[model samples]
Target: MTVDAVEEPFRTQLTVRLRQGDTLLGVPLPGPCTFTSGNGIDILWMGPDEYLVLGLELSRESSDLEAELSRESSVLAVVDVSAQRNVYRLTGVHAADVLAHGCAIDLEVAPVGTCVQTLLARTGIVLMVREDGFTVLVRQSFSDYFRAWLADASLEYVS
Candidate 1:
């Protein structure tokens, strides 16, 4: 297995809660249990009216989004909590199998471009399936445990 911690860009995560009919930071809203991207941003839908906005080097974009959201009458809340979570990426042939050891999601059959909030090593996580692997996000407090568990889960496949 090939697992590496991703050096995230200057984080500017903006959690946006919509009041109604509001798109996310000018990007189209994602469907249920879906993710949508525009420009360099990816919006992960957390609920009917909530989303998490993420991207690389998104400082300026974050500010613009925050201000834009403030002007929208339909916006419920826009809060930045960029430092609250840590992200890691695991890619390679055995990546999914390793994650499956602790992740409840069926990565073996999940389609590409899928993202779901699930548990990894009993830790809350967001798992994003890409073309060849998965991106895992864990809350700050559990990041260390998540990483350790990932290392152990990957031992069978790692050389």
Candidate 2:
């Protein structure tokens, strides 16, 4: 199995109540329980009125997004969490099985573009289902252990 810590394009997380006709950086906010992408930016629906934005970490664009969303409401919040987590790209024929060892989520039935917040080895993580693999996002503090666990869990399949 191949498990590598790879750099993501960029991420901007936000918490706010998005309403009809609301747009962030000209991209229409994805409604509840869905995801939307525009211009290479993907917005993951994490919770009601909550989304995690992924794209290139362009400083100027970041500023523009923030400035525009700030007016959404007084409770609207745009936070840059690009550095808060370590993302591991786990790929191989056995990668999904390896994740199932710890994750209770049924990846076998999940769509390719789905993202689920779940636990792996008792650590909170975000698992993004890809066509051939998964993108696992864990907090920086837990990255080392998470990565090690992945290595051990997939040894049988890899070897």
Candidate 3:
């Protein structure tokens, strides 16, 4: 198949709930339907007061990150949700087409930093649009199902 799926398991993920106008990782939290990346971390806006911080190859443990984040005065909760979800990357020319089969959003029009919580193949996922492809975050329990569904969805593009 032209579309390739790869799983990136067990990277640090933090759920931070903070007061208005708070900042993390030296960058302000993104606005609705958007995400920001800096200092080896990507911060995605999850709600009015919540953001999902994705760490990339950070030298610290999830707990360490949590403790550091919790130190902020405006921070209300800093949870290490690393074990709660699995990440998948879909790439290749047909990637978006494969996603279109199950996702309702028009990801092609969405900017590279766009991120949204939605359902794909009836499974809840946090989808991030990227220049290379797309990143899909699904609950750990539903990862297998989502992978299988992704495989099935890309079948037609195989020739």
Candidate 4:
């Protein structure tokens, strides 16, 4: 018997930490820019005074984006977190059901296009739900385990 391997598309994640009173890329973000990933990237408000920037593609310099922000003020600290985390997308009708198994947040009330940083099976995960699917961000060290768990949870709907 011959079996075909399932191919999953990869999504890149870039995380940048912005300090308080610092503007991103010289662009003054008055108040926490809601739903604005800053430069069309996936950004999240990690704390009252902190923001986590994510993106699918990165520039050659690595610090290109951060440098732009630094031009405005010297108070912001931008750090590249590409090597520290893994990003995944989960979609389909059963997406919510699968997430409900391990996620602590209430998906029903979270609404679409909204992002939430929460725990999944004791591990920290950032979840963003859209109309088609949900994007999940997890630590690189736990990616393998997390993927395995996600696959297992998605078994029921794959076929």
Residue 71 shift from truth in candidate 1, angstroms = 3.1
lDDT of each: 0.76, 0.69, 0.87, 0.61
lDDT of 3 by residue, 47-139 (tens): 999999988765567877788788888888888899899998888899999999999999779889999999998899999998899999999
Rank candidates, TM-score, best first. 3, 1, 2, 4
TM-scores of the candidates in the order shown: 0.87, 0.77, 0.93, 0.75
Q: Which candidate do you rate higher for lDDT, 2 or 3?
A: 3
Q: For residue 55, give model 3's deviation from the true position in Å.
A: 1.0
lDDT of 4 at 123: 80
Instruction: For residues 6-39, write the lDDT of model 1, one tens digit per residue.
Output: 5455556778888887465577877776677776
**Ten consecutive residues with minimal summed lDDT in candidate 3?**
56-65
Could you tell me which residue pairs clash in candidate 1? none
Q: How well does candidate 2 match the true structure in TM-score terms?
A: 0.77
Q: Indicate whether candidate 1 or candidate 4 has the larger TM-score.
A: 1
lDDT of 1 at 80: 85
Which of the numbered candidates is closest to the native, going by highest TM-score? 3
Candidate 4 ranges beyond 4 A from true positions: 1-34, 58-61
- What is the clash count for each candidate, in the order shown? 0, 0, 0, 1
How high a TM-score does candidate 1 get?
Answer: 0.87
